[model samples]
Target chain A: MIKVKKEFILKYGVPSLAVIIVAIQLCLVHFQDLSRWKGGGFGMYTEIHYFYNQIHVSGMSVDSLIKDDPSMRSTLGYLMLMPNDKNIKKAAELVLKTTHKDSVYLQIWKPIVNSENGLYKKVLANEIHLKKSEL
Target chain B: MNYWSAIEIKLKDQIALASQLLLFMLGSYVFILAEEHKLWKILVLFFGLIAWLFFRNKTKHPIIWIVFFVLLTIDLFYSYFWVANHHFMLVFMVLSVILFSYHKQSDILLKNIQLLLVIVLLASVMQKITSKQFMSGDFYYHAINLGGLFKFFFTIFPESLEIAKSNSESLTTLKELNPNLTEHIVLKDVFPNLSFVSRVFAWLTVIFEFLVAVAILWKPKKIGTHIIFIILLFGILFTRLETGFVSLLAISGLYLCKNIKLKLLYVLIILGCITLIITKFGYH
Candidate 1:
């Protein structure tokens, strides 16, 4: 029995963990708008949507707000890569705190290609309208 | 002699050598292109080179492996957003080596490495198949025209370069325009039959990846399996110069390889990958 347990663990342990991780990654990709190229799904180069997605902020001066704050820059970078609700909310809150604004508008845009006519366009993948009190 | 004991004794030297090579590969990757954290890069390079040179008996220096593993894990979490898939594989590979260092079991380590290769490839294949853009070949089409790693395709079809330039200009214009404007720019494709070519490339990618995964799982120790891996590596390198990933795959292949000639080839590939990285070839 001990030998069997050892064999099973030795053979199946890491691979099983890998499968579970992949499953979680798929969920993130499906629901949370996580880029297929990230989170260890081995989904690199599978789609035109890459980690270079753009984050747009409205109703505030992003440059003046993030110029001195390295942490906000890093947070925005993460938000570009993963623009899920949580990251969007986090970024919105940061904007609200920095600019002393009542609310901020944030949108994540990903480049997409229309196959029929080869038209290139940026589509909104996620958006958030968060107020100061919403945090 | 007991079966596992004999097997361990037989593979003892080879596993040590494999561990050293993997450490070197990991170190080189971090030093060259990975590890956005500067302090971690220096530490990994220092310890990796030290371990590679002086630590002949890896079991005696468990702390080094532990430190290396911990550093890689920290980096993985720190830069999780931008980290490549191969970076994750590197962490898992180090973990397997750490396990081997503890248990002194070569077979388990080999099995784990084999399984890693299979799972990664299968997952890649699954992702490609399930993605609508990939199946329709739009992804490859965009990549080839966008001029990163797929710029080599321009040599075959020179007119696509002009199209790519136009596309770039249009995309730049589009970006500069109002964000709320729902305008679509029609990207030009002047290269003849480029769509068909992209479809062929996409299908070939899926088929080759699936075949390589099956080959590795079917015969972990056979020369044929190694050949398939080499073919896949070259296939990917031709279009996309993923030197880090190529070296990682070669290191895992080396762990399972017993033949001297193939083993030498794997080492050469790893060194070649390092050289490619140093030269800044295909670096975007």
Candidate 2:
């Protein structure tokens, strides 16, 4: 008779199962591109706050940004607000990239981007204190 | 021992001493998760609490499993992907504890907790390594920049927001060419030397995360291991408050400690964690 030690199950079986489950879930989410799926556009508070900040910092009026690429006005707010949710951030980035490709607007407002494997996510705010010497 | 004999041996420790503590921890977690709900979640926690107090170590009771199963069912219905992943594992482990009737499988139960700690820590290491921004340090850089700790400092001084706003403006202009820039831009005046320091902190976090994962697998018997756990726990406590669930895993490490003195110390650490959790939650 084959003897199965309790230690074997605890040490290997359960943990392995957990890892496998997470891996599968992550894969499904990424391949489905669920992060980029359009949701209800940003609420008013998000719109006004981000637009004002952009205008203040870059000297690019919100009117110009909207006129050049209307999609950007809807997506920029999410880049600033939803930094932690990787999928939502990715979706927001996808919208911005599509709308402002090769434009100076793209240069002036870049969301912090992080990629793992094939998945990419963006965050607001970049490192401001690093010197050329450090890089 | 044969398979059957192993099962028989596992049944010997009929009472799991920490079952009450586990119930309290998991119950409180569920209550917090479902705090905004009407009555279903609250009633479940209330019943679970009553059962826990009345039957602390009576792990063999069928009613206990039923209550837990009901909780699990409700949790599944409400489980969204955004709910931190650890909470799912907590629910699973809690159910397993109830089902195994730690009264009958105390040793196995302890092993379950240990396995949980190892898996969580190891997966975290993998996530960091796989994340390109984490390796390049940009992820950490921005995370810290936008994190609660950074905002908390500004909250107290309020005067510093001007410097922060000015620094942020300049930083945005520097990234016009590349949205995914990993390198940092030097601040003009206030905290002039901090960008590199932030980068170093970022790398340190990854290293610390990797080390803690290894410590759990190494069994954390030595004082050095305990210190690593402490540094990581308190470090997150201040930097990234959201990951505070790790405190429970540290408490779970007590199961692996060889000596009574160390176990007592682990208990005290758990108390400290509970107090911190209360403070954060209450304030929120």
Candidate 3:
């Protein structure tokens, strides 16, 4: 074993250990899915569950995807307005599609886009209350 | 030497070690509570422990504190809302460490720490007093009923029959709606007539917070006052188990002891930190 001086350890040890700990912590971000999931229950909805899961599916930044695709926006809008796994999974699926040319996401979008009553805009505006900043 | 002089000497000698112990304890709690994987949390805690032991006495350098700050900031970003109170404590510890390193003066650092504690306590009092739900005791009632503490107490106490009966029904409905909300209710609330004891506890919480704010500034050299502060802190910790105990341990060390042998305290804190971090593995 290599010999390390007590004084040297005293000076560099804690900070080095701290850096290592931080590095490990940062690395764990990649495996968040495997570690745990706090999906909402009790009639309430968790927006971030959809937000992060959808982001993973889309492989794009939230703002960039929302800007580039109407379907992604509507999926998010559906998530904010509607509760349940089916709708949320539909939103996640929308992100995986190559383009929004087809009206496959219409059911999710109808409430958010087709209304002249401004209900869609209200739902979209309510996204500000969402816990996940990325969503 | 007079009593006041003895107390002052004790405080001057032990405050640094006490603050360090507090930081270690708080850091440990945060590590365990952080939203990360078991392997990662363990790795971080193991390395962090070795590092903390090495630098426990090296308060002379600012780099150690800066490193801790950087780690805390990263943890804050990863679990922004879950561990917010833990983040707050880290921020205070980091700021205090920086101040102590630069000034290299015990008196100035103590004063600043005192100021920070006072502000925190006063702010808690202000929040309690201003909140409509908190004042009316509804918040506490819901919290206690939800946390199951009310049921626990109801079972033990014969005189609390009214509260027990009413709160049991409420608990069933609330838990059915959201099973997780019943985890940790810090308020110790009681419903049904807002029972005299629960109301007293509620008002006393606000008053005690205010008194703690006052105690920090009233007489720094009095042993009696420090004891009162420690008791008040423990009282708060009883209701709120998460972050209050760390502060209690810290304040006990900083303001209570005169010439404490910190080796034992440090070991205990380190152990607790490890245990807490281990607890975090799958919690998040």
* Ranked candidates, highest TM-score first: 1, 2, 3
RMSD of each: 5.3, 12.3, 14.0
**Model 2 Cα lDDT, one tens digit per residue, B60-87:** 6756556665765575565433345555
Clashing pairs in 3: A14-B51, B10-B258, B32-B277, B140-B189
DockQ of each: 0.66, 0.10, 0.04
Highest TM-score scorer: 1
TM-scores of the candidates in the order shown: 0.86, 0.60, 0.51
Q: Candidate 1 - CAPRI tier?
A: medium
lDDT tens digits by residue: candidate 1, A16-126: 878887888888888887778889899999986554466778755556667989989888877876778888888888888877888888887888886557777788878
- List the pairs of residues colliding in candidate 1: none
TM-scores of chain A in all candidate models: 0.85, 0.24, 0.29
In angstroms, the error of model 3 at B123 is: 0.5
lDDT of 2 at A48: 14
Candidate 1 lDDT for residue A47: 89
